[model samples]
Target: MVNLTDLLTDLAAESADVDSLVAPLSAGDWASPTPAPGWTIGHQIAHLAWTDHVALLAATDVDAFFASVTTAPDPARLVDVGAEEFLAPPDELLPRWRAGRAALAAALAAAPPGEKLPWYGTGMSPASMVTARIMETWAHGEDVADALGVTRPATARLRHVAYLGFRTLRHSFAAHGREVPTAPVRVELAAPDGATWSYGPEDAADRVTGPARDFCLLVTQRRHRADLALTATGPVADAWLDVAQAFAGPPGAGREPLSTRDTTVSEVTA
Candidate 1:
């Protein structure tokens, strides 16, 4: 069985990191735009805070959580609802976010084993729930970091995110109303600590090999597949790169593949 303790620990650390990084931002900074298209820094934080609160409810009191949620008439616009609902002065939003995240970390860590928690699109085990939270933190943290001109380095915690990405391949495919291919594809990633982390069967013909940071970036929709140095083989595997998403939701419009121009051989072969 997967250990939820380690996953929760990592999530807590990552959450704290995000909190510290965003703590220094001024009202002007929070109003700045992020890499997430039209979403501003405040919007990003509000989204995280709102989701954190919901996750806490799911972990601790599933019935109340369900009862408390008011479904929007338009489901597609639901993501926008949280931002609008949480719109407040920076001081108010910040404290709500801080409380929400802390509550989430505590609730998730205390969840009983074998319990399934409802999430955006599917139910998640405590381990999967925490991993998904960590993935969200790192993904949005990247955008927040980018807005602040800070480079967030990759960490071994990515092993869990990569695990989630590979595990969700079928979901990603199915979300598009397409059938998932059964043949396994190899995922060989170069971890930052000079170690190789791999997924899928060793004998599988399909393969995706690249730096770990790049793979995480690709799965999170933080970078277009073309922007990263990853190689895929086999038609199924090759096509998967065109639409890879870790976090669950509607089939996302993956970022556009960028031009392979002014590029070096190392960039391709690395």
Candidate 2:
């Protein structure tokens, strides 16, 4: 089992880093186009904050959380709310967002070992919550960074990201109407802290080996797996890459090549 405290600490650190990056941006920068089709930098941050709120509710009362909230009508509607939610002049949305995160942290801290909480149509234990949060933050952070023409600071938290990638393999196989591969694929992540984290079987038909950050990027669909130095030795490993999804949803439509230049916000919304 994973350590909840360690995972929470890592997630908190990454969330704070994401907030720091956004706090200094000019108003115009918030609306800059990110890689997720029509989402903006501000939209991405707001989505994170909103998800934290949902997580808090889910931990305390799953039925109410799902009942009270509705997904934004469409991608454009979601982006509008995401950009405007915390920026509205009078209310305490930012404070609420911060408080929600604090509550989420507290919930995780206080949870009994192996206590499962509702999330994304499944039950995740407190330890898994940290993994989910860290993966989400890092993945969305990449969207913001891609919009700004900047790269985020790499970190060892990416082990969590890689694990998320590994977990998604089962879903990927199922989505394609294939049996989940029983053969384990080895994963070697070279973390930013100079720590190496490995998972899966040592002598298997395939392997995925790369810097942790790049592995995170690829699985999240923020960057193409081919662009990184990651290798896949078997058909299952290659198939996993083609359908891997870290977000809560159906499998993505596959990756498209990213433009070297920053995409225009108008182009995305159009």
Candidate 3:
């Protein structure tokens, strides 16, 4: 069982980690493009800030959240619209994001035990909400890092992300208009610290195994499967990799693989 306190703590850490990456940036640096098509580093942070705000509403004010949803701009471009609307100057944006996330943590901590918060497509317990936030923080942080040509070290927080990915298998299939498979798929990943993290039935015929970082990248649609070292054994597992999405949304247009031919030519030229 996930402890609400623990998940909230991890959520804070994940948010802080991303904060550290953006805090020192010059205004111009915020304009750097990320792997997410058309999203700059500013858009990435703005999206996080906006999400945290709405998540706060879900946790504390149900009616307002529902109203916001009902009145929201196009569902398809809502994410992009939110990012644009919430964007601000770095100094102002940084403090707002920091304060808002802190308030969200406090709200979640005080939420009634077993209280289900309204969210897009589903309701979430406080713990589950925090876990989703962590996943988003890390995933968007990956975009920010990529924009700046920085690398982030993988940590055990990936366990939360991996767990969410595993749990969302059905959503992945359904969003893609495929039949949700009843077959259990096992996932075994090598953690950053050389430990093994396993999920699903030991006897399950479908399985995915790989580095935890790669698995997180795959499920978050941060990288193309071809660029990762994950191995999917059996048909369900193989097909799942093609459409897996950790976050709730329509099927993402995942990043394209780095072309081997282009890479070789660049290498030769250098």
Instruction: Tell me model 2's lDDT, rounded to 2 decimals.
Output: 0.71
Estimate TM-scores for all models. 0.91, 0.85, 0.95
RMSD in Å for model 3: 4.5
C-alpha positional error of residue 207 in candidate 2 after TM-score superposition, expressed in Å = 1.4
Off by over 4 Å in 3: 260-270
Screening candidate 3 with a backbone cut-off below 3 angstroms (N, C-alpha, C), the clashing residue pairs are: none
lDDT of 1 by residue, 1-270 (tens): 878778878987887788888788898888887765567778778888877877888898888667656545666766667666776667888899878877887787788878889877688888888888888888878778877878887888888888888887887788778878888889999999999999989999999999999888888877788789999999878978877788777776655544642211111000
User: Rank order by lDDT, top first?
Assistant: 3, 1, 2
Q: Alpha carbon lDDT of residue 112, candidate 3?
A: 87
Give a tens-digit lDDT track for model 3, residues 40-147: 788888899999999999999999999988898686778888888889989888888899899999999999879999988889999889999999999999888877
Cα RMSDs, all models = 4.8, 3.7, 4.5
Which candidate gets the maximum TM-score versus the true structure?
Answer: 3
Clashes in model 2: which pairs?
Answer: none
Clashing pairs in 1: none
Residue range 192-254, candidate 2, lDDT tens digits: 898888888888878887788777777777666666777878887877777667665445554
- Lowest lDDT block of 10, candidate 1: 261-270
